[model samples]
Target chain A: MKILVCISKTPDTTAKISFTDNDTKFNESGVQFIINPYDEWYALVRAIELKEKDPSTIIHLVHVGPAENDAIIRKALALGGDEAFRINSHPGDDYYVAGQIVNLAKEQHYDLIFTGKETIDYNGSSVGGMIAEFLELPYISLATKFELNGNTATITREIEGGEEVDEAALPIVVSCQKGMAEQRIPNMRGIMSARTKPLKAIEPVAIDPLTSISSFELPAPKQGVKMIPADNPEELVRLLHEEAKVF
Target chain B: MSVLVFLDQAEGHVKKSSFEAASFAAKIAEQTGTEANGIVLGEVKDDLQSLGKYGIKKIYHAADAQLNQFDDEIYTALIADTVKSSGSNVVVLSNNFNGKAIAPRLSVRLKSGLISGAVGLPDTSNGFKVKKSVFSGKAFANVEIKTDIKIITLNANAFKVTEGSGTATIENITTQIPRRKVNVREVNVVKGEVPLAEAELVVSGGRGLKGPENWGIVTDLAKALGAATACSRPVSDSGWRPHHEHVGQTGLTIAPNMYFAIGISGAIQHLAGVNRSKTIVVINKDPEAPFFKAADYGIVGDAFEVVPKITEAVKKLKGQK
Candidate 1:
C-alpha cells in the first residue's frame, strides 16, 4: 500500500500569538516552530501505524512550502515516514496549495492520503476535500476512528449529536483529528535513519493564487473582568442582563 | 447573478448555524445589490418559507430522500450543478461539519476561490476582500478573492441571524446526482443531549472540579442556563468526561454567545477553542487561574459553593424548579 501524509509547520502551542507591522503579518521573531500537532499526532501517526501493520506499506510525507519547512518534514521522517517531498515555494493560498498537492498525488498515484483536519495556523480545513475533488476520490473529514479490512475502510466520524459509521474502498482521502492515533516521539535510531533518508525538494506547478492576503489584524484586547462578590450571585445575573445584555 | 446559500440540516430540522449562513448570504446580497437564494439537498421537516425572514428571496430545494444522509461526493456534484444553473457568482455555506466536508470539494470542482471560517462580511469597496480568523482565532486576515466565482463558509456564530418581514418562496429544482463512493452503514443518533456546536451558551468544567462525580455543578449550571456542558482536555484525557464534550484546540471549537468556565485554568489550547465566544465568565477558587484573564466576569471562589449559588440564582430568575 502506498500512503502519503501531508504535514505543515506551526508555531508551538505554548507560544504567545501576536501580529506585527501594523498587524499585517504574523510575528515569528521569538516563536519556536514545530510540526502541527494534528498532522503529527493524528495524520502522520495513523499512517505509520498502517505501515507497521503491513511491512510492504510505504509511507511518504509530503509538504507544500518553502525550504524553511524542510526541517519539519525531516521531523516527520524521523517519526516514521519513509521519505519526504517538499514543494519549493511559499504557500500562497489554500487553492494554490491544494493544486500543488493534487499535482503530486497524480504523479505518485497514492492509494491513500491523510492530512490533519486543519492547520492550527490557517485553520482552513480545505485541502483534503479539495484534493479529493481534484482527484475524484472519496474523502472523509474529522474522522475520529478508522479501520482497514482488505480493500474496505470503515470510518467513524462524530456528527452533530451522534456518530456516523461510513465505509469506502481503497484509494481514498481522510482528514484526521484526535482519537485517530497517539503522538509518537522520534528515538535516536529513527533520528539517525532520518538523517540518511531521502528528502526531495521539487519545483511547484506555476499557478496564480486565487486569493491574496491584504492585511492582518489582532483581536481587540478583552476588558478587565468585573468581579461580583460570591454572596451577591443575583447581582451577577443582573449584570449579565443589563451590562452584558447577553440574555 | 444571485448569491447561493446552502442550508444545512440535521436529522430533519435546519441547523441554527445554517440560519447564520443564510443571514450572511443575504447581507452579501444586500451589499452587492443582488438577490439571495437558498438550497436544501435533503428532505427537511422544518418550514423552509419561514427562513425568508433571514432575507432569502427564494429557496431552491432538492427534496431527494437519498440525500437524507450526507454523501459529500454527491453533495458536491449537486451543489456545483445548482450553482451553474442558478447563475450564482458567489456560494455561501456555514462552516459546520457538512459544509467543511463539501465546500472545498465544490470549490475545486468549479475552480473557484474558497475561504473557510470567514468572520466578517466582505469589503467590496475595492476588489472583494473578506476578513477571516487565522492562527486559530488569534488574528484576522483580509483576503482578496481574485476568482470570478467565490465560495465562502461563514464561521459558526460569527454572523448573527436577523429577521425581516419578507417570506421566502420555495422553488423546486432538479439536477443530476453523482455516484457515491462512500456508504453510510449506520447512524447512531444521540437523543436529548444538547449539541455543543449550536448551543448559545456553554458551562464547562476542568480538573479543579475534582472528578466525574463532582460534575453535577457543571450540569446544574448548564441546566439553569439552558446551556450545553463542556470540559477541558485534562478532564477528557483522564476519562472524567467524554471526548466529544472536550472543548479545546484539538477538540470541538465553539463560539457560543456566552461561555462559563467553572474550574478551567485556561491553557492556550483550551482558550484557542472557546476564545471566539462573545462573553466569558470564570469562577475558579484560585485567584491566579489563567481563565480569569480572558473572562468578562470573574468570581474568585470555590466551584463547590459558587456554582450552586449561581444555579439557584438562575433558577430563581427564570422561575424554574
Candidate 2:
C-alpha cells in the first residue's frame, strides 16, 4: 500500500510571533521553523507506524511550499518517510493549497492520505475536507485513534460531547490529531539513512487564490492584573461579579 | 439571493454557538437587503419558530433520524442540495466541530468560496471582504471572497447574539440519505458535563496540580463558576486526564468569555487554543511565569490554598445571588 502524508512547515511553538511591512506580512527574521507538530507527531508518525507493521507499505511525505521548506521536509524524511516530494509553490490560501495537493495526489492515486487536522499557523481545518471533496472520497477529520485490518479501517473521533467510532474501506483520507500516535525522534541511523533517500521537486499547477489577505493586525495587549490579598479571596469573587461581570 | 444559516444541534437542542451564527447571518442579510433562513439537519426538539428572535424569517428542518448523529458526507450533500433549492447565495455556520467537518466539503460541492474562522462581518462596500484570526490568534487577516457563492464559518463567541421581535415560519424539507461509506458503530456520549465548545467560561489545570487525585481543585472552581474543565497537553499526555479534555494547539481550540488557567506555565501551544478568550486569569506560584504577561488577571500563590479559597468565595457569591 502506498500512503501519502502531507506536511507543513511552521514556526516553532516557542518562537515569538512578529509581523513586518506595517503588519502586512509575517516576520521571518530570527525565527526558527519546524515541522508542524500535528503533521510530525500524529499524521506522519501514524503513517510510519502503519508502514512498520506491513513491509509492503511505502510512506511518502508531501509538502507544498518554496525551497525553504525542504529542510523541514528532510527532517520528516529522517523520522521514517521512505521518500519525499515538494510541490514547488507558494503557500497561499487553503483552497489554492488544497487544489495543488489534490492535483498531485490524483495522479499518484495513493490508497490512503493523511494530514494534520489543522496547521498550527493558519488554524484553518479546511484543507483535508476540500481535498476529499475535490477527489470525491471519504474524509474523516480530527480522528484520535485509527486501526487497520486488511483493507478496512476503524477510526474514532471526538464530537461535540461524545466519541464516535466509524469504519471505512481503503482509499480514504484522515486528518489526525493527538492520541493517534506518539512523537518520534530521529536516531543516528535514521538520520544517516535519510541522507540517501530521494527528494523530488514537482512544479505546481497554476491556480488563482479565491481569498486575498488585505492586512494583519496583532491582538490587543493585555491589561495589568488586579492584585487582591491572598488572605482576601472573597474580594476576588466580588471583583469578578461587580467589576468583570463574568460569573 | 438570501442568507442561509446552518444551525447545529445535539440531542435535539440548539447549540449556543449556532445562535451566534444565526445572528451573524441575519446581520449580513440585513446589510445586503435580503432575508435570512436557517436549515437544521437533525431530529431537534427545540422550538424552531422561536429562532426568529435572531432575525430568521424561516427555518427548514431535515428531520431525518439518521442525522441525529453527524456524518459529514451526508450533511454536505444534503446541505448543498438545500442551498441550491433555497437560492441562498450566502451560507453561514459556526466554526464548531460539526461546521468544521462539513463546511469545506460543502464549499467544494457547491464550488463556492469559503472563509473559516471568520471574526467580523463582511465589508461589502467594495465587494465582499471578511476578517478572520490568523497565525493562531496572534494576528488577524482581512480576506476578500470573489466567488458568487460564499460559505462562511464564524468563530465561536466572536459575535454577539441579539434578539428581535419577530416569529419564524418552520418548513420541513426531505432529502435522500447518501450511501454510507462510513458506518458509525457506537457513540459514547459524555452526559451531565458542560461541553467545552460553547462554554462561556473555562477553568483549566496543568501538571502543576501534581496528580489526578488532586483534580478536585480544578473541578471545584469550574463548578462554582459554572464553567467547563480543561487541561494542558502535558496533563493529558501523562494520562492524568482524558484526551477530550486536552486544550491546546494539538487538542481543542476554544474562545470563551473567561479563561481561568491555573498551574499552567503558558506555553505558546496552550495559549494558541485559548488566547482568543475575551478575558484570561492566570494563577501560579512562579511570578516569572510567561502567562502573566498575557493574562488580564494574575495571582501568584499555591494552588492547594488559593483554589479552595476562590471556590468558597464563588460559592458565597452565588448564595447571595
Candidate 3:
C-alpha cells in the first residue's frame, strides 16, 4: 500500500504568534518551526503504524513549501516515512496546496492519503477535503480510528454531537484528529536511517490562486481579570449577571 | 442577482449555526441589491417558509430521503448544481463540519474563491475582502477573494441570527442526487445533556479537579448552567475525561459565548482552541494562574470549594433550588 502523508511546518505552539514585515507575513524571527503537531502526532503516527504492520506498505511524507522546510521534512522522514517529497514552491493558498498534493497523489496512485484535520498555521481544514475532491475520491475528515481490510477502509469520524462510522473504498483521503494516535518522537536508529532516506524535491506545476491575504493583525489583548472573592459566591453571581451579563 | 445560503440540518431540525449563516447571507443580499435564497438538501421537519424570518425570500428543498444523511461528495455536487441553476454569484454556509467539508469542494468545482471562518461581512467598498481568524484565534487576517463566484463560510457563533417579518416562498428543486459510494454503518453518540461545540456556555475542568471521581463538581456546574462539559488535555490523557471532551489546540475548537474554566492553568494550546469565547471565567487556587490573564472573571479558590458554590448559586438563580 502506498500512503501519502501531507505535513506542514508551523511555529511551535508555545511561541507567541506574531507577524513581521509590518504584519503582512508571519514573523519567523526567533521562532522554532516544527512539523505541525497535529500532522506529526496523529497523521504521521498513524501512517507509521500502518508501515509497521506491513513492511511492504510505503509511507511517503509530502510537503508544500520552499527549501527552508526541508529540515522538518527530514525530521518527518526520521519519524517513520520511508521517503519524502518537498514541492519547491510556497503554497499560496489552500487550493494551491491541495493541487500540489493531488498532482503527487495522481502520479503515485497512492491507495490512501493522510493529513491532519487542519494545519496550525492556516487552520483552514480545507486542504485534505479539497485534495480528495480534486482527485475525485472519498474523504473522511476528523477521523479518530481507521481500519483497512481488503479494498475497503472503515473510518470513525468525530461529528458535532456524535461519532459517524463510514466505509470507503481504496484511494481515499482521511484527515486525522488528535485521538487518532499518541505523539511519537523519532528514535536514535530511526534518526540515523532518515539520513539515508530518499528525499526528492520537485518544482511545483503551474497553479492559480483564487485568494490573497490582504492584511494580518494580532488579536486584541484580553482585558484584565476581574477577581471575585473566593468565599463570596454571591459576588460571582452578581458579576455574571451585572458585569459580564453572561447568565 | 440572487444569494444562496446552505441550510445545514440534522435529524429534521436546522442547526443553530445555519440560522446565523442564513441571516448573514440575507444581509449580504440586501447589500448587493438582490434577494436571498436558501437551499436545504434533506428531509426537513421544520416549516421551510418560516425560515423567511431570516430575510430569505425563497427556500429550495432537495428532499431526497437519501439526502437526509450527510454525504460530502453528493452534497457538494448538489450545491454546485444549485448555484449554477440559481445563478448565484455569492454562496454562504455555516462553518461547521458539514460546511467545512463541502465548501472547498464546491469552490473547486465552481472555480470560485472561498473564505472559511468568516467573522464579519465583506468590506465591499473597495474589493471583496473578508475577515477571518488566523493563528488559531491569535490573530486576524483579511483575505481578498478575486473570483467571479464568491463563497463565505461563517463561523458557528460569529454572526448573530436576525429575524425579519415575512415568509419565504418554498420551491422544490429537481436534481440528480449523486450516488455516495460510502456507507454509514452506525452513529455512536456521546450521551450528554449539552452539545459541546454549539453550547452557549461551557464548564471545563482540568488536572486540578484531582481525578475522574471528582468530576461531579464540573458536571454539576455544567448541568446547573445548561452548559456543555469539557476538560483539559491532561485530564483526557489521564482518562478522567473522554478524549472528545478535550478542548485544546489538538482537540476540538469551540467558540461558545461563555466558558467556565475550573482548576485549569490556561495552557496556550488549550487557550488557542477556546480564546474566542465572548466571556471567560476562571476558578483556580493559584491566583497567578495564566488562565486568569485571559479570563474576563476569576475566582481565586480551590475547585472543591468554588465549583459547588457556583453551581448552587446558578441553581438558585434559575429557580431550580
Interface RMSD of 3: 1.1
User: What does candidate 1's lDDT look like per residue over B187-272, in tens digits?
Assistant: 88668778897788899999999999999989988988888899999999898988888988778888899999988999988998
- Clashing residue pairs for model 3: none
Residue lDDT tens for model 2, B218-267 = 99989888899999999999999998898877788888999999899998
Taken over the whole model, the C-alpha lDDT of each candidate is 0.88, 0.88, 0.89
Docking class of 2: medium
lDDT, model 3: 0.89
TM-score (C-alpha) between model 3 and the true structure:
0.98
What is the lDDT, from 0 to 100, of the residue B95 in candidate 3? 79
Output the worst ten-in-a-row residue range by lDDT, candidate 3 chain B.
B189-198
For each candidate, what TM-score against the reference? 0.98, 0.97, 0.98
Model 2, backbone clash pairs (residues 3+ apart or across chains), number: 0
* Of 1 and 2, the candidate ranking higher by DockQ: 1
Model 2 chain B weakest 10-residue run by lDDT: B312-321
| lDDT of candidate 3 over A43-111, digit per residue (tens) | 999999987888899999999999988899989988998889999999899888889988888889999
Candidate 3 vs. truth: CA RMSD? Answer: 1.1
